[model samples]
Target: MSNTMRILGAPNLYLQGPGAIERIADIVANLGKCALLVADPTVERMLTPQLTKLLTSVGVAFASAPLVGEVTPANVARLAGDHRADVVIAAGGGKGIDAGKAVSRAMSARLVTLPTAASNDGPTSRIFIFYDDDHKLLSAERVPRNPDAVIVDTQILAGAPRHLLVSGIGDALVKRYEAAQCVGAGRPNMFGGRATLAAVSLANVCEQVLREHAVDALAVAGSGKPDESFEKVIEACILLAGLGFEGSGLSIAHAMTRGLSALPATAEALHGRQVAYALLVQFVLENRSAAFMADQFAFYAAVGLPTSLAELGLPKPSADDLRTISSLTHKAPHTRNFERPLSEDELTEAMLQLEQMRQHSAG
Candidate 1:
């Protein structure tokens, strides 16, 4: 076989520490003189005053905007048109960060991401998953390149809800397995190129670090303390997982997430929480050994990740709901990356199988 071309993409700069956000002035200065800070309502109330004071002290002119809802194209367009700034700093969770990325692209302005939570690996990625008003997955928009910079502050993350950290673990834990599946399937990554050795290796490291330190990280983070384990696991969850998934590829777990968005039952669930349960379904879809599944379920339980449909708020999902999820997943673009094409029937069977194993696994 001919050698496959490999590609990798990453932010121009990445800084992570307990009080990294304190360096906001310096980071923004390097990008431009004027900055537009974007955040959701909650994060805006939490961080805007602090960020504004810091930027003001450094003499950087800046404007602040609050994203009211989902990161839709219309919102991005509004952001690009409403405020004129040299750079855009997206702060908060995934949606806020994604909105900033999209706005920066539309304006052709420089981009910086300051993630307040390790919810998902969205900070360092060039891809943005957009949704409709009802939170249905509409499309995934890819920037021409990754952000100019990504700054993650563990002190901020430590104070976040414990559910967020646990959800991040669920998302990060699947990178290794999904990357391996992509390689086995000979699929192109998000960059539309073959998986690089670096990407796959990082995915391995991501899995190892999470398996070893996730519990410790969760414990300290829940206590509102930034410990070494939180630092390590957050890096694994955000940076490594971001790089690995973008440079390696996506598979069943992520495709299933696209489907989960279709159901109102899962609307309240966080992205990683839904992905957590989807990973078990991915395991079932692969027909993985019972021992492997048990170990995974144990790890999920230890960290309070979602493993059963009940955990995802679908204790008894209707047959119609199951069919809808399966149909959406089957039709998702990412499903084509699987080594074997997954049929809707296969997806339904996997979901059913995972459901059947719930009692047995708990027992």
Candidate 2:
């Protein structure tokens, strides 16, 4: 399979800080003349005037396509077909950015992503996830390349809901764990090549940033101020984690979370939140030491991540529920990415063990 090759992928340009959004007009102009902006309703309402002024000053004609619903293939297809523009800018939260990625791909337009919330790695990855009309995850579509640019205005991120940042930390926390597994096994990354030294290093850095700064960043993020810790955490969560996961690889942690979709009861849980708890299950599957598990458990609890299914709104998962989730994990393509075989029984046992630990930690 030519697994010896090394590969890395990333957005063309990444801009951050308080005034980054103000530069979007020039950035968009450099890429294309006329742009179509697909933004969440909230972004359209809150930032349109400033965005409009910037674009006008730069003489970049732009049109707005407000995102009215969840990111689904049908919705993205519709947007791509309906909007004829030189470039597509997905502005706002994860859904809007994902829609922008898909729509840009469908239309063959240059892509730009402006994320208002530091909630996940989707903002910069070459992958965009879509859900079915029923809100079930449909697929993770890989674009030909990453976004042309990813603009993260920490001013906006600072004002975002604190949970979003915490969830981002949850998502970023797994990068080193998963990447280390992939590297140790000589497994191929998302692009079907071995992880490069650079990719592995980025994953390690992402984990280090989260370990050191996430909690303090969460504290200042609530006040809506762009502090140093907030900037570092945002970079780790969005940029570094994006590069790390996509360029290194996803392992059991993500596979387990993806499996949670099989349960209708977990439909309301956030993606990052699900991954946070699933990491504990991975620890069990890997037979990590109790000291290591306890350290991770404490980190999750301090960051407000879901440490138990109860927090995920499924406090009492029946045996059937556990079996279903475990089976789903076994069926996931990512589960196979692990060096060792992953079984449904192991998943079930790990989940139960996670719950027991949660109880013990509580006591």
Candidate 3:
């Protein structure tokens, strides 16, 4: 008989927000006992005390792994083996959440991802970034478990740097187009699987919210207000971006971002920042109407996301580098959904076109 059954369940839930950290006790005590909390030093200092206090209040056994660097294999091995946690609580930004996902999977424990910053969709994802010893990415690792719970309290998310919130909006806005590309290219997602109908619908919702409330939401995030508009944007950043990308599967936009991130110049840009630029490149490569993409630029500009190369803090790639990287991008696991196969020359041209758009827009 063909084994035909798939209904995975999250062992714990994620909780987000300012005072949301204080609720850790209520959420975790009900889930399990011994817990391992993973975060970076800075994030730890910012969010850990509250987490610790909450855990202490609930009488849950716990430990901490303040991840100091990228989630290299060594990092994962060290963390997963060292903590040996029964349940995992990942706090802070995307990196911390991805690292915690790795730790939870490796150690055969339940995971909960808490994001202090709405920087990307990694918080609600089951995939984690993998890296080589030198901190270069290997690829994404697909884990068996999705976090049992995802907790987002608008209060905590709004307090993050406005730039992080802008990046989140950038990351979210590109999903609709990326989903189309993925479908066109026949590319599999992080799971090496196809996109589901549920995923596609989620992506559309994300795009609609982005087009509608991104600026208002971002303003609220920056302004210390949790009004209806602010709450809407936070919801879009978390639930919409989170559920959309994971469910819909990425296409050229994200694939392009992954490829761009491999470049040294773009390596330092935030995930959402990189994703925003990738969307620009896609508009060029796919022959998408500038008028259509112009709205995207407007939305990003309104939110303070860098709409140009100068804003992204990078120089133009040399023709040689662009050509070489473009050739390599074809091999990306997510590129198959693109409408046309990209060549080195085409990729190089796309970069040049983006440069021109940036220059034209700036002037």
| Highest lDDT scorer | 1
Candidate 2: TM-score? Answer: 0.97
Instruction: Quote model 3's TM-score.
Output: 0.90
Model 3 weakest 10-residue run by lDDT: 1-10
Q: List the residue pairs that clash in candidate 1.
A: none
The local distance difference test score of model 3 is: 0.73
lDDT (10s digit) by residue, model 1, range 1-363: 144788999999999998899887898898898999888989888888888899988888978888998888898889788999888998888888888888888878888999988999999999988889889999989877898889998889999988888888888888898898888888889888899899999999999999999999988875657989889999999999999999999888888887898898886788888887887888887889999988988888899998877788888898999999999989987788777888999999999999889788667
Greater-TM-score candidate between 2 and 3: 2
Root-mean-square deviation of candidate 1: 1.4
Candidate 3: deviation at residue 353, Å?
1.7
Cα lDDT computed for each candidate against the true fold = 0.88, 0.85, 0.73
Give the winner by lDDT: 1 or 3: 1
The C-alpha TM-scores of every prediction are 0.97, 0.97, 0.90
1-363, model 3: which lDDT tens digit per residue?
122221222224555455665666777777788888888888877766777777877789878889977888888888887766678888778888888888888888777777878888777778778866545568878668678777776777777788888888888878877877765566554444566676677778888887778777766675555667766666677776666676556766677655666666766788788778877887888886778767767767777776655566666666665655576566776666678777667766887887787677768
lDDT of prediction 2:
0.85
